[model samples]
Target: MSTLSIRDLVVSVETEAGAKEILHGVNMDISSNETHAIMGPNGSGKSTLAYALAGHPKYTIDSGSVTLDGEDLVEMSVDERAKAGLFLAMQYPVEVPGVTVTNFLRASKTAIDGEAPKLRTWTKDLSQAMKDLRIDPEFAARNVNEGFSGGEKKRHEILQLELLKPKFAVLDETDSGLDVDALRIVSEGVNRAKETTDIGVLLITHYTRILRYIKPDHVHVLVKGKVAEEGGPELAQRLEDEGYDRFLVNA
Candidate 1:
């Protein structure tokens, strides 16, 4: 089984006041087939940890190391990290104006795999994944995320997750803006990817509702950019019942 390890990770971002640290010594190890949920309040560095793992230029690694299976992820370029089997589903997916969804997914698959998927197999898989996500066939022709609703954009993110087959996925608040129906659909998509590929997941979210559907193997509460508590799925239930009130006070 592959492993994604985060050890004492310290990350920062530029602000009007200059460099400001966000994540403070965050650490976790996720293996294939394991799901870890990161629950935190707003500005608690949940997204910062996600983007830092994905090597976003906006976030700087002040110290610590991220490795996938033994290779240094922090040393790799963004695309290089992706090629190394890392994926991030952004909280707010950006619009790619001129790129059709079909073209974008196909090109991304090509880039990561280093070869174009055979036309027949590629077409079949693409059709199946889109249908599974309940995305309209017409979406294949539309520009990536352009003019799409919140649910539509989120579905498109899962579409890439399903197709790209990454080893590890850090989903940044994917449950946000999803209605009940959309939530179930998207959750199913995530579960499908995990079952099929044994992909490690670091799911970042505020609410425990998504946990009900996704069933995290482990739950971590991040307060003030640090892990305040860690436990099994029961921890998520407690967070739901008690909320982060106690943790915020301690933070």
Candidate 2:
């Protein structure tokens, strides 16, 4: 089984004042078909960990080791990391004005596979995925995420996850801004990916509602850039009921 290992990962970002560290010595291990939910308050370095894993330039890896299987992910470029089976679904998906959804998906698929997908097969897969996600077929011809609603953009992110079929996906607050129906649709897409590809997921969120749809194998609570607590699925329910007050008071 594929494993994504994070060990003592410390990451920082440049600010006007100076470089400020965000993640402080975090460690976690996720394997194929395992869903690890990262629940934390705002500024707990949840997004930092996601971007750090995806090799975002803004988040500098001060020290630590992140590996996919045995290869070091810290040394790889962002695109190289994608090719290495790491995918990050951004919290706020940016719009690509000139790139249509169809073209962008095909291009990304080719990049990760190092070969283009056959047209007939690719088209059918794309249509089915979009349909399953409740995305309108016309969305394919539109520029990627251009003028799309919050739920639409989120669905687009999952669409890529379904088609690209990465070994691991770090979903950074994917449930944010999604309504009940949209959330269910998006969650189903993630579940579909896991079932079909055995994709490992690092699901970051503030609520347990999504966990109801995509059950996590493990739950981690982050406070002040450190993992404050870890447990099984029950931990998520505790967080939902108790909130992060205990963790915050202790932090």
Candidate 3:
């Protein structure tokens, strides 16, 4: 059964000129324990799809419905969506200078789960997760993403995925701007998250490097704001070998 479903989704953004359509009748179904990768060139509306799925205010859903585990996701607020088992790891993680990572995690857990994590048990789990991700313990006490490097910011996003364990996660370009080592670490964290939970993954990326580590069960080509093509993992290899020209032509 699909954990998340987007049916005939149409989204537009408001600009000074007028409403500009970004997604045009796109549909997808992601199932539990499945990893799906959406790949497309720049301006193909990949990130727009992610934001739209998360119910971002900027991207207006012109029509269609989005459901999470058969629940109406389109009607829920962003925080409600999170509480309803949907998570979006953004392309650009925001930095808050005053909020420590520990505090942020606790608050998010409380908000999503309806109560704060028990101090003794939650901290132990948090420490173990940090250690597993190779993040220093002291980093938790520091402000969230404030002084973090690009890779560190990505790791912090993964940390939340681990702690929160949402039912479905839309990771927008999680592999961007990371060195080889950081990529592996981040991939490992993603793998760990999958092992610990039955979360479905929708990874949006341009590069194929991350796929080498975190193999996708399915690969989709997004072009002209829609899925131009889709196939098993071999489709990702074809894109890696031959580039997107063939797909663009069909798109």
Candidate 4:
């Protein structure tokens, strides 16, 4: 089975004030058939773990290891990691000027597959994916993320997840800024990807609303950069009902 193992991961970032630690001794495991949710307060390092997994150069891995099956993912470059079956849906997708959505998606798919997708089939798939995500067909000609609303940008990320079919996806606060309807659409897209490909999901979010639609198999409460507690969906319910005050108090 394909599995992602993260052990005692410590990460830091450089600022004008010098290096600032984010994730500290964080550990988790996700299998292809599982969906894991990480819930935490603001600045509790949930996003840090996501960015670190994607090999963002800004986040320095201070120690520990991340492995996919038997291969060392921490040693791989960003593109290498993508080719190795890793995907990260960023919190804020940036604008890619002068590139159409169709070309961008096709190019990325080519990069990971080492060959171009069959034009007719790729077109059909892209069209269907956009329809499933409720994206406008005309969006194919627009530059990626340029002039797109927040919902549209987030939808594009989920669109990539569906098309790329990564072995594991780190969705960093994907629920943020989405209204009820938009959140449901994006969550549905994620569920579709996971069911079709058996892709493991490392979902990072502060609220449990997204969990209502995604239904994580495991829930982790992150506090002060480490996992303070973990359990089944029941844990998420408890956190939602009572809030993270207890966890924050301890921290």
Off by over 4 Å in 3: none
Error of 1 at 251 (Å): 1.8
CA lDDT, every prediction?
Answer: 0.95, 0.96, 0.92, 0.94
**TM-score between candidate 4 and the true structure:** 0.99
Choose 2 or 3, whichever is better by lDDT: 2
Local lDDT at 214 for model 2: 98
TM-score winner, 3 or 4: 4
Candidate 1 wrongly placed segments (more than 4 Å)? none
Error of 3 at 188 (Å): 0.7
Predicted candidate 4 versus true structure: per-residue lDDT over 1-251, tens digit per residue: 69999999999988899999988899899999799999989989898889899998889999999999879999999999999999999999999999999999999999999999999999999999999999999999999999999999999999999999999999999999999999999999999998899999999998999999999999999998999999999999999899999998888
* lDDT score, candidate 3: 0.92
Estimate the TM-score of every prediction: 0.99, 0.99, 0.98, 0.99
1 or 3, which is superior by TM-score? 1
> How many residue pairs clash in each candidate at the backbone level?
0, 0, 0, 0
The clash tally of candidate 3 reads 0
Clashing pairs in 2: none
RMSD of 1: 0.6
